[model samples]
Target: MTDPLGQQRPIDIKAQLQACRSKEDTFKTLVMLSKTQPRLTAEEKTEDNKIKGCESAVWLIIEEKDGLRHFKADSDAKLMRGVLVAILSLVKGKSLADIQQMDLKAELAELNLSSYLTSSRTNGVLAILDKITSH
Candidate 1:
């Protein structure tokens, strides 16, 4: 079965992450992606969409359609918005089963992001993952 993105194979998020030459490059890519993401309107950034556990105010929208999950997110912090996009890019438009089976920890480990993430940011990322994977 094909997903909405109509992929013959899963997008290799791990590989994309690993391709980054350095942590600085990763942040550069993240900033670029974040700039492309549309800013949230006041309504969309309300309590209903607010993401908990993030040190900064982050909001998320998760929806299931045609057996696939779709994600959209925003954050007050510039960097967090990029993290949201990265998280979404990895799991968005994937089948629920595929999403549930994803080894997020493994992927993050491969990205070698631990050195760059603070405790709060780490928790925020995990919280975002939980929110996406759960109801």
Candidate 2:
């Protein structure tokens, strides 16, 4: 997918995240992609351990095994769960510097999520961000 600015781009983090609009859309895409990729187990979904801060009871687990970062996450809210999956897809295997360098605010604007998110839902998204950056 190309951006509105008319640029053909590589598979960078920003472009990948800009592909979705609402959190639900993000989730749906992630779920569909995961079908062809790999399914995350319950045990693997515990990274960064910020599950307690999530409004919808989300669990995220990330690990740096070998040279790649791995993530597995789940949430009671289907949409939020999908959002987490989308986030994992972008940052899961990246280094800390790469994850930190991502323009999360710009990506969120591209996704057009601010108008669609509740305060709690926004908080939940922040929790996910914290998890990614913390690792």
Candidate 3:
């Protein structure tokens, strides 16, 4: 699906992520995806946009246009940025109903990265998912 800004969506992100055979490969993919995540402007990094309950400072901006949601996010931590990109790949440009219906924890489990995450990191990821789905 095209994003609100009309950029082509990442190709089969689930497939790409699931293709990784090792944690190193997964981390590489996440880093690659992180490179594509849009930077939140200094002005846009307001407290209102910052995600609470995360160890790292994360800012998410969700814009709705033509009945679709567009997500832009950033984080002070690189791994968090990668995680945000992965999460955004799933929900960006989708309708609110579609996003709200997602089983995000299941999706992450499918990616097989759950073992790599600390409890705090998992909670942070959930915080990001909550921010997206709740919007």
Largest TM-score belongs to which candidate? 3
Q: Give per-residue CA lDDT, model 3, range 1-135, as digits (tens).
A: 545665436556677778999888888877876777778899999999998888889999999999999888999987778778777877877899998898878877776576557888877888888888887
Estimate the TM-score for candidate 3.
Answer: 0.88
Q: Pick the candidate with the highest lDDT.
A: 3
Off by over 4 Å in 2: 1-50
Candidate 3 segments whose C-alpha is farther than 4 A from its true place = 1-11
* Candidate ranking (lDDT, best to worst): 3, 1, 2
**Candidate 1 least-lDDT 10 residues:** 1-10
* Ordering by TM-score: 3, 1, 2
- As a whole number from 0 to 100, the lDDT of residue 69 in candidate 1 is 85
Candidate 2 residue pairs in clash (backbone atoms < 3 Å): 27-82, 46-60, 46-61, 47-60, 47-61, 47-62
Query: Per-residue lDDT of 47-67 in model 1, one digit per residue for the tens?
Result: 878888889899998888999
What lDDT does candidate 1 reach at residue 101? 96
> Each candidate's lDDT (Cα)?
0.74, 0.61, 0.80
